[model samples]
Target: METVIEVQGLTKSFGSFKAVDHLNFKVAKGEIFGFLGANGAGKTTAMRMLCGLSKPTSGSARVAGYDVQLNPEKVKQNIGYMSQRFSLYDDLKVEENIRLFAGIYGIPRPLIKTQTEALLEKLHFTEERNTMVRALPLGWKQKLAFSVAVFHQPKVVFLDEPTGGVDPVTRRQFWELIYEAAAQGITVFVTTHYMDEAEYCDRLSMMVDGRIEALDSPQQLKEKMGVASMDEVFRLLARKAKRTE
Candidate 1:
């Protein structure tokens, strides 16, 4: 496909601390790219920059063909972002939340209704359309949050630790939703602590102390580290970091 996100020498620093250092990566259209790292590894920082929510202290990034620094608004328009914490009005009915976001994106009322119905049915949330978001279960809320994020048909979706607190089965279901979006030509950029979820991604990058230490398919990363699983690969890479430090 096409290049949905491009980064080169992307760096973000706080005082003397480098939160994200010289990161370089590309995500292609319709691909699910995983961003993996332990806490404080700068994954969030890098993601924030890519999503146009934060600026890089130095270097550059482009999202959906718009330069992040010069055209942050354009970049935001073409991308959807879901944080680990769900961002929806708890008191609003599910459909209302959808309408609110649709309005925020300036979508026409008729198109909003049509798309909302289609998405709710496709995601199996149509029956719960009038229910309060606060009453929904954690898993359902996560799904709704994701659906709302991409309701505008954004070219790229950025999910930051979306399944962090979800159970394994729920996480799998969430990944299924992610797969559906990717199949429909939306690029998925996600950060997660779940190694199994990492395995589901088309490609992944592991960050350490603000820089990427490994970038590959999960299977390839395991092979390179002589490990049996992504968890092992992460452990081995982390150990290497400690030794060098």
Candidate 2:
């Protein structure tokens, strides 16, 4: 498979503090890549740089074949993002939100209607098309937010803690959607606090103290660390952080 995202010696600094230190990784096309980390581990910062939301202090990253620093706009065009905050207009109806994102992603005006209908139908949201986004249940809102993020059919989608605060059933359903997207050739880059979720990825990278401390398939990581599960692997690695001292 083709490499869709490449990071080489990527670093980001906030004045005297380093948020991402000499990071390096690559994400393959259509692969589900999980990025795991405890709070302040720099997962968000690294993802922000990859998504072109923040500038890197040194080194380089190519996302969807566009240099993050040199071609931020082009990079943005080829990627979708669903933030942890569930970015959507609360006051807007479901259909309106879908149309809004379709326009923002530069989808042709003529195709927006068809695309919106298809998306609503696929997610079983056709009945709620006219309902205000804020009126929907939390799980429905989350699913809708994800659908809107990927509606433009970008090559890669960044999901930042996409299932935060959701019930187990909702998370399971959300992962099903993720699998469907990956099957259709969209590379998934996700970060999550849940170890169970981490195990579902094709591969995972665990970050500690602004650097990736472990990068491997969950099974490999478990074997390498001599652990029985991702929860144990994460606990052992995360405990090594200096802040935990």
TM-score of each: 0.96, 0.98
Expressed as tens digits, the lDDT of each residue in 1-245 for candidate 2 is 79999999999998978889999999999999999999999999999999999999999999999999999999999999999996999999999999999999999998999989898899899899999999998889999998888888889999999999999999999999999999999999999999999999999999999899999999999999998999999999999898541
Candidate 1 lDDT over 1-245, as tens digits, reads: 68989999999989998888999988899999999887888889899998888989999998999999999999988999899988889999999999999999889999998999998898788789999999999998998899899889899999999996898898899999899999999999999988889899999999988899999988898888887988898887766454122
Q: Which residue segments of model 2 deviate by more than 4 Å?
A: none
The backbone clash count of each candidate, in order, is 0, 0
RMSD of each: 1.8, 1.1
> Which residue pairs of candidate 2 clash?
none
Q: Under the 3 Å rule for N, CA and C atoms, how many clashes does model 2 have?
A: 0
Residue 21, candidate 1: Cα error in Å is 0.7
Which candidate tops lDDT? Answer: 2
